[model samples]
Target: MTTRVATETFPMPDGSLGARLTMTAGRANSLEPGLLGDLASALDEAEAQDTSAILICGGRNFSSGGDVRAFHRASLDGEAVAYANAVVPRLQAIVGRLIAMPRLVVVAARGAVTGGSAGLLFAADLAVLAPDAFVQPYYAKVGFAPDGGWTALLPERIGAGRTLEWLQSDRRLDASALCDAGLATAVSDTPEMTAARLAAEGEIGTRLATKALVWDEARRARINARLEAETAAFLERIVQPDTALGMSRFIERIGS
Candidate 1:
């Protein structure tokens, strides 16, 4: 997995900067540890540059969720407990950085955004999905609970009842539907254009100042506490017999 940060400068005299970071993988840029480290480095640079806004997306699918192959390996190797301890907490911390970033964070999703990717979408201040893009919480289908702050963030965008239904089922939602549900700000023809539009809509000075204030107040300590709880619950689901059963059933259903 590789995380490449691209900096595109607009003619904004307002001193606000914007960047787009693409987390890429060899095949499916599943959320591997090295990928996460690369992302953290990119975020550090973005923060240092004092970017007014940041966009997170992928080359193809925003992510196929976590590397299923990695999960499968970990389970078979009996490393689930150790892997969960090391990875889940780091994931939660990275997500914390995202949520607490001073500027508005936009997710430009172009394809099927599932699993942990879905959780990252929830961390966004705004999300722009391609018209044909699909998004869903696919954890339960894979025999796991929600992670990537989905439990904490989903209900904030969609109603609690709806969030529950989505989490419990294997339904897929298109970009337009996500926009209608307030999970996404709009649907774009392309992720690049979406990033450009968001950049154009802002004056650097004002965007930066406003974003800082928003992050400060909006991300109270309670939010972090909730995020930690969410991660813990998600990890617990990994070893549950029901989760294993659900995963097997899902795999068979999908003919995978």
Candidate 2:
């Protein structure tokens, strides 16, 4: 197993809290199980501090989603089902927490954000992407259905029809397309700095109030249900012959 680094939290100058994901090695910050636990703990610490806003920043690629190579290895070891069942639920829980957070949430991402990592864009109240950043829905390519709230939250941003089309196309969405589709608040050369400035300048009370008005318990419940269904379906599909073949090919490509 790869060594896991905890999420680091820093006090921002503007009275907000900043959280940086420290797990950037291997497959562009892939979502390892330990990283997920660190993320959840970091969020809890941020809330405990009563920070006015929360800023999440990542490495060069923000995240490349779950580690496909790890999945392939697990499959070869005959542990794919157990791996998916353990990881997907934790991913869903983290996504749920992000959606239900009381304070403002902001994300600054660069490089390729795909798979489960792309779901973070939708859960965030505001997201800033670097000019070179791209979002890719990689589930279809891997022969797994979307999970981590992608199916539920993406449609709210880009509409059901467009989201379905985009998912099926298996294409990467550039910064401009993400901004135009309402998934990104802005596309900037310095996305992390821009996100910090925006969080500092915005009125905390108003932003929190607006979020409260827009997001309610019932909607959250629906999202949770959808996440559960997606996770279950993905676990079932990933063990099939086609998905196994697809995963093996992906591992080969990455290895080469």
Candidate 3:
């Protein structure tokens, strides 16, 4: 009821239920102020319903990250700071929630996952990427400091040294590379089905218990603290003239 699409409940391995949330709004599933909060609320709904696993299927594309075109417009209007203020905190909350979510969190990544991108994609218990899917970081090119857990959750998933080097370079992490880096759990033509099948393999209660132990309050606190740090740096950079210029050029380069 909270999302653009209906929540489809599925069968989990232990005969409990699972929920599937499909995102479909804006081009390439671009992030919107309302949509982000709605999705987060949808997760709340699923959790309230006691769903053991939740599958997020991003329609067409996983996401083009935050709406750069919108950001570009905000820059032109000198309201980029306000726009970012509106967007980032909500996004950060969802990413943090996923980090310590008791029920399994899964993302079905289909097209491009770019920009500071969806930290939730990386934050998920499992990300099943479509074979042709790719994730790229455009923060350097856009002159934006990484938000959405680029520096936070990612280093936790990959590694600190590698994350730094990777961020500095211009590269696309294709599904294969994503798997090899341990960012994605698997790559398949049908990512939703893949996620569903994976979700059906374990005893939900026991798995959730282990999740609680591993993603403990201490770990959750660390992740939240790091996310807050990213938010601070991001707000500082997004208001700068250089980042406004970068946003302009990047949007023109992409012809959007």
Output the number of the TM-score-best candidate: 3
lDDT tens digits, residue span 1-256, model 1 = 4244344434334556677787776545667776766777888888888776787878667777766556656766777767666566666777777777776677888887887667778778778888768987777667776777776766666768998888787689898888788888887788667666776575656765775665565564656787789777867887777866676676567564
After superposition, which runs of candidate 3 have C-alpha atoms over 4 Å from their true positions? Answer: 1-5
The Cα local distance difference test for each model comes to 0.72, 0.80, 0.83
Q: After superposition, how far is residue 104 of candidate 3 from its true place, in Å?
A: 0.6
Per-residue lDDT of candidate 2, residues 1-256 (tens digit): 4444445565655656666444455667788787777677777777777776777777788888888877878888899988887678888898888878887788899998889888777898898999999988888878877887778777766788998898899888899999888888998888988987777665677888888777788888888888888888988987888998988877777774
* lDDT ranking from best candidate downward: 3, 2, 1
Which order, best to worst by TM-score? 3, 2, 1
Candidate 2 TM-score to native:
0.92
The pairs that clash in candidate 3 are none
Best by lDDT: 3
Deviation in Å, model 3, residue 117 alpha carbon: 3.2
Candidate 3 lDDT at 89 equals 85
Pairs with steric clashes in candidate 2:
none
lDDT (Cα, tens digit) per residue for candidate 3, span 1-256? 3455457798775777899988777777676787787788788889998898999888778888888788878877888889988888888888888877788888888888886555868788888999889988888889778888988888877789888887899488899998999888998999999989998887777777987887789878887898999988888998888988888888789894
Q: In the order shown, what is each candidate's alpha-carbon RMSD? A: 2.6, 2.3, 1.6
